[model samples]
Target: MKELNFFKCKQVIENNNIHIWLINLEIYKKEINNLKAILNSDELSKSEAFYYRSDQERFIVGRAILRIVLSYYLDILPKDIVFYYNHYGKPYILTNTIDSLEFNITHSNEMLAIAIANRSVGIDIEYMYCGRNLEEYMESLFTTYLQKDLRMNTSEEKQKILLRLWTVLESYVKATGKGIRYPLSTDIRNIVNQHTKNLINSNFEISIDTCFLFKKIEIKDYICTCCILEPLDKFIIFRDEFILELPYYFEKIVR
Candidate 1:
């Protein structure tokens, strides 16, 4: 929480540099009232439309937190920021303050993940749920090749592979802002190959690179991933709570 102050106004987010902010939705629950005050009328109406009390509160908190976080980068009041969504329903900053500001948001249960970068970026976080019919559910969403690979793996291994594959595919479509328009039937196995990672270059067409590029984020009890248009030159994850800290930094950011 204290560290968020150290984040200077408008840090130059480079084209290939991406920063991921992970927020635990529960932490902001206590401030729900204050959070709601920051939301605009449209957001408020959207929150009101939610049938469940918990869902409504979460919606309010998430939108308010997004505005607060973006304010630091845009150097504007949180309430003043506005968003415009594309044809596919992906949101982007509408301000002329900076043309490069692009972001994507995702949440699962109590976890909220946001990715911001100079270039187009997308992120997804999913709770790891290994249900009894996990394979059956995955079969409908995955290509035949991925399904075959999953079938050959043991239960534990299958869960791990299924998590990565599913999340990466999600992140890819989100990055493109194509949403469900992009076929789920893509054989993404070849793009995620280990050998390709060592050979990936920054300069490439959108077609081939989009198929091959995605970063997997390791969060306990969850599967997370991010995708960017170009090769990810720099990647940083800032969490509201101290959770998975490893080869990455151990400190928390954006309370």
Candidate 2:
């Protein structure tokens, strides 16, 4: 009876699902100056350290956007939110108003993805541009995603498949806060093999604490993966009346 109840409880959590906010950086370019002021001195210095102008802008914009998203739930000014880093260098914010809330961020080029859930979560997105040398790119992929016979798929199709797989691998490390030290050489091909047919509901093992779910989000020309530490059977993309400006405020989601 207890075990059955555990599954039932998980089902309830799944019904609530993950909340993701997709930020399109291009739309916010005109507000860069406004976003710049949202950063604290520490973040300003870090942003300045980036060599490229574009890189600096991304750091500032990404930080500001993350805070704005959190501000909605916290019912606070975005600039007042304080962030602390865990041992693995993942950033987290604390709010006495909310409990059991966890979030993660990932960005590639102009697209930024933020995922929030009731459990530890990590999110990753990759713009699928054909800039990588096919040979070198496939070398990094696990054997399970690679074809034994080179004739299995067209070059374009293969790149999409392998690149999508890459995001899943990345989501694991990010979700774990394992950082750069985690083995990038891990061949998830075999582990992911059993779960590929149902990408959104995929679950494979890395360890007891690694992940309870691996999910794919559909965004054209980009591959996105989200990993959650606790099983959630469903997810929702949050764009209901969202604005790139300051948060519109929201009720506290977690208790």
Candidate 3:
């Protein structure tokens, strides 16, 4: 990953490509005030409503960074970015012109990720190294929904596979514009065997349709999945560690 310093926040998008930004939420500790300043009223209210301070910080930083990153692509001020939600509560940018930009956000532990693509996309990350708690999560959250093929290996291996499966499934549903509001037990069987045949063999690819493809991202100690509306092999994965900086326009006084 290359470290870049620039005059203004900038991001580039390519045809049929997705850019995944891995952001370290801990950096928000010192810049919390500056981060909060960039958020809109709605975002600020949502951040302030978090019960835990850590959650609040994450919300503020996450939403603030989301706006900042999105602004570059939209050629708008971060504070001017507008969002509207779908019937299933999936958020979309409100634009006068037809926009193909699509994005998804997911956070695990202190790490947050934002995926931007020109087509439908969804992303999820899971921290499965939570000691014995992972076992409890598997039993309580995933055991019953486990597909026949995913029920392999010992306890530890099973938990890892379950987390991977969970991320893939969740990302798939999110990509389809249905968030967790959709029950997993009823929807779990929707994934075709041929689509997830690579999953059981420890290969990560979930075929949503002829055009949509899913792949697992290899992040140390974290399970992440991304679903995009393009052939997986056609696009190359570019990894970059994002460092949040206040946009230059935010520093200028608007007369």
Candidate 4:
């Protein structure tokens, strides 16, 4: 994993065609001020600026991590990377460069992660103890088959397993840039298998070429998944170490 010094922050990882940027939100003091400047700028509408600024600190961390990771692939300044929202409201790259780097950003609690790859890629991370009744939430958010699978795997050993599945599904939807347009009620196994096969057969098609590779990573207490439209021989997972620095910042800022 390659660590970058861009933006004066540490703990950025890059391998093969993939880049993962992580940030522990607790450590950054200047982030809030920086985000406020962006929000207060005349470039954004009053309502839009106010909405984003309301959660400015979190979004600042997310965008900072995104800028650093993307800088490794694009020559543009981190703040200059223009973004456009898709029909489904997901943000996407709008550069004229031929790099074709696909990426996704996500944040939960104090941990924020971003993934960038040569093909369409999406990633997600959720805290293990987010105060949800797992069984009840699954029944409402997942398909009948998935609910049954969760029920059958009643052993305590499956908490991580359930999270793994959830992350993968979330990642797939994010990669497609569809968000919840493709609901979680769809069969998980079928989606993975079918998407992989479809990508292989339609590699020459423009749409398929936009998203062709997919992967998932599971770390202690965290589950993350990546989806791409291109084929991949193997994936290398790197658990970012920078999250350890966040608590220091949080202690100073939030308190």
State each model's CA lDDT, in order: 0.69, 0.66, 0.69, 0.54
Highest TM-score among the candidates is held by which one?
A: 3
lDDT of 4 by residue, 1-255 (tens): 223234323322233456555556555534445533433233334334545543555665556556645654576556677767888878778666554667788877677777766666788887776644455543465456555655665444346555555666677778778875434445444553334323223121212334444454444565666666665543544334432233322111110
Per-candidate TM-scores read 0.78, 0.77, 0.79, 0.65
How does residue 196 of candidate 1 score in lDDT?
29
Off by over 4 Å in 4: 1-16, 34-55, 140-149, 152-159, 182-189, 192-214, 233-255
* Residue-level lDDT tens digits of model 1 in 1-255: 221231243455666778888888888787787777778999999999999999998898888878877876787877788888899889987666776788999988888988889877888887876453455655666456656755786886677565665666678778888884534435444444422222222222233444435666767888787778776667777776432122333334321
lDDT of predicted model 2: 0.66
Off by over 4 Å in 2: 1-16, 133-141, 144-146, 149-151, 180-211, 245-255
Over the stretch 1-255, how does candidate 3's per-residue lDDT look in tens digits?
Answer: 333233265555666777776777787567788777777888888887889999999888788778867876777777778889999888889665335789898988877778888778999999877553444443344334354445666777777776776787778778878876533555445453334446644565655557677777777888888888874433434333344443333221111
Query: Number of clashing residue pairs in every model?
Result: 0, 0, 0, 10
